[model samples]
Target chain A: MYAFTYHRPDTVRQAAGLLARKDDAKIIAGGHTLLPTMKQRLASPGALVDLGGVPELKGIERKGRGLIIGAMMTHAEVAESAAVQEAIPGLAALAANIGDPHVRHRGTIGGSIANNDPAADYPAACIAMGAIIVTNKRKIPAEDFFQGMFGTALEEGEIVTKVAFGIPSRSAYAKFRNPASRYALVGVYVAKRGGEVRVAVTGAGASGVFRWTAAEEALKKRFAPKSLEGVKADPSGLNSDIHADAEYRAHLINVMARRAVEAALGK
Target chain B: MAAVSMTVNGKAVTADVEPRTLLVQFIRENLKLTGTHVGCDTSQCGACVVHVDGKAMKSCTLLAVQCNGASIVTIEGLAGADGTLHPMQAAFREHHGLQCGFCTPGMIMSAVDIVNRKGSDLDEHTIREELEGNICRCTGYHNIVRAVETGAKAMAGSAPVRQAAE
Candidate 1:
């Protein structure tokens, strides 16, 4: 890893100021993804603005009909948070299954979504739940926040502060994970809010996590597993790798979507 | 260079380290506590697992500077001051949980953490699931699972029982 100056800021304003001032400074929340990248020499920032010391960016609370999760809350904290569990059990489950126990203890939700790994689980939950990505600068809807694999709408010096997720009427996530890395091979998150239904797929999109509109439209008609009888995930833009071919991923997407719906319905 | 200070194994220690120095490097090189091993530099293997502020984390993945004020407990801290083994350590010895023993320190530390969070009454499935972070290359998981179960029970017995308030 390249040697870089490290700054531990006490507040979001100071952290953002450091990020804006440094030409090549990156925010370090949990440092799970960034540290590994640096270790491999894939990224070399001149400075690192550590957000671990920022008090404003740490918490999980329910606001009205949604939950406001601080950017610095670790996966373990989220998974164990009573507020998160009561508000969105699916999200809590997703947090519990990320990587392993050790990883969850240190990895934060903000880092996971900001990195925007194609196979990450949080993106699916955020998009399916219609979450709002709150940054120091502004708020971006989940649908518009994620651009593609390892990409987001975040501008330079913008730091994610919190994520607000609406309490879905019913929601559940089902994942087929890669045994080695525990990353999603093909994961699906299903959510229903009144008359609207959203189905998000991760680890299958060639570009990144995407909503399966056909499945969503079908489920909106009838919120049941049978509602997705003929709906299918098109293999055209799905990921194809040694772990799973595009066709296989497509099939798994449909299967996982059905399972997610079943789980949401307590079937 | 950054000056980092933290309590390791109940002792306060301070050192000057590079910003990129991993916590494992500080624990092993600067502090000269070599029980914590780094099997995989990447965060996959849990060989370097240690408790920071009372939670198990992979030391290799954490920068020493990040743990500047945090209290850390490594494998060397698990036993009593008089050399009494922690229940989990004793259980591993009785159950023969390790073969090569390369992963034993991490496995034991993670086991203690599991017991702390999940309670002493653990099922076989839960033990296996919780052991996801620590990988024993020997694949000696059966005995390790047994050891965790027994160790959890032993830990419960060793805890000071509180008297009921009148």
Candidate 2:
């Protein structure tokens, strides 16, 4: 790893100030993805602003009709939080099922969303639930936040403060994970609120993460596994790798969507 | 380098380490805690797993300077003062959970934390799902899962751990 200045600010404002001043500074929240990249020389930031000491960036709470999770709240905390499980059991289950116990305990929601790895699970949950990402600068809707693979709309030095997920009537995340990394080979998150249904697909599509409009529309009419039949994922825009081919991923999109629907329905 | 101080295995220690020095590196190198193996430099492998502030974490992926003033527990500290094996360690041995054992320290550490937080009632599916980040090249997961089960039972004080399942 290259040499860099490390600063552990006690407050978010101080961290933000350090980030704004350094031309190439990276915020370290959990450091699951970023640190590895740095070690591989994929990223060579001039400074590292550690967010672990920031008190304001680590918590989980229910704020009115939504769940507000601090950016630094670890996956383990999210998976085990009584409030999260009670309010969004699917979210908790997804958290509990991510990477592994050690990764869950170290990786944070902020780091996962910010890194936006195509196979990561939190993006699907955020997009499906119509969550709002609260950053130091502005609030970004989940729909507009993700730009592409390993990309988000976040500007430099803009530390995510919290993510606010709207409490859904019911929601579920289903994925066929890669055996090695446990990242989704093809994952789906289906959320229902009122009469609307949102389907977010990760790890399958070529665009990395996209909404399955056909599946969503079908499920909105009647939320059921059968409803997703014949609604094929566009294989042209799907990812293909050694773990799974495009055709297989397309099939998994349908299969996982069905399972997600079933899970959401408590079947 | 930065001057940092923290408690490791219930003892206070201070060291000057590079800003990029990972906590696991500091523990294994400076403190000579080689039991905390470094598997993948990436966070995907939990081989560098350790308890930070009483929570399991991928220490390889975290900067040592970030852990200033925090409490840490590594595999070296899992044993009792009298050198008795931790319940998870005993269970692993009883269940033949380790083959080559490269992943044993991490697997055992992760399992211990999982049962501590999730409880002894954890089903096989949950344990399988939770072990996703921990890779065992020997593929001894069949026994690892059984070990976690037996260890959890022991933790709950239900009974002496049973033999490996099937």
Best by TM-score: 1
Compare the candidates by lDDT and give the number of the best one: 1
Model 1: residues >4 Å from true position, as ranges?
Answer: B160-166
Model 1: per-residue lDDT, tens digit, B51-150? 9999999999999999999999999998877677888999999999999999999999999999989999999999999999999999999999999999
**DockQ agreement of candidate 1 with the native complex:** 0.83
For candidate 2, the docking band is medium
lDDT, candidate 1, A191-223, per-residue tens:
999999999999999999999999999999899
> What residue runs in model 2 are displaced by over 4 Å at the alpha carbon?
B121-126, B157-166
The collision pairs in model 1 are none
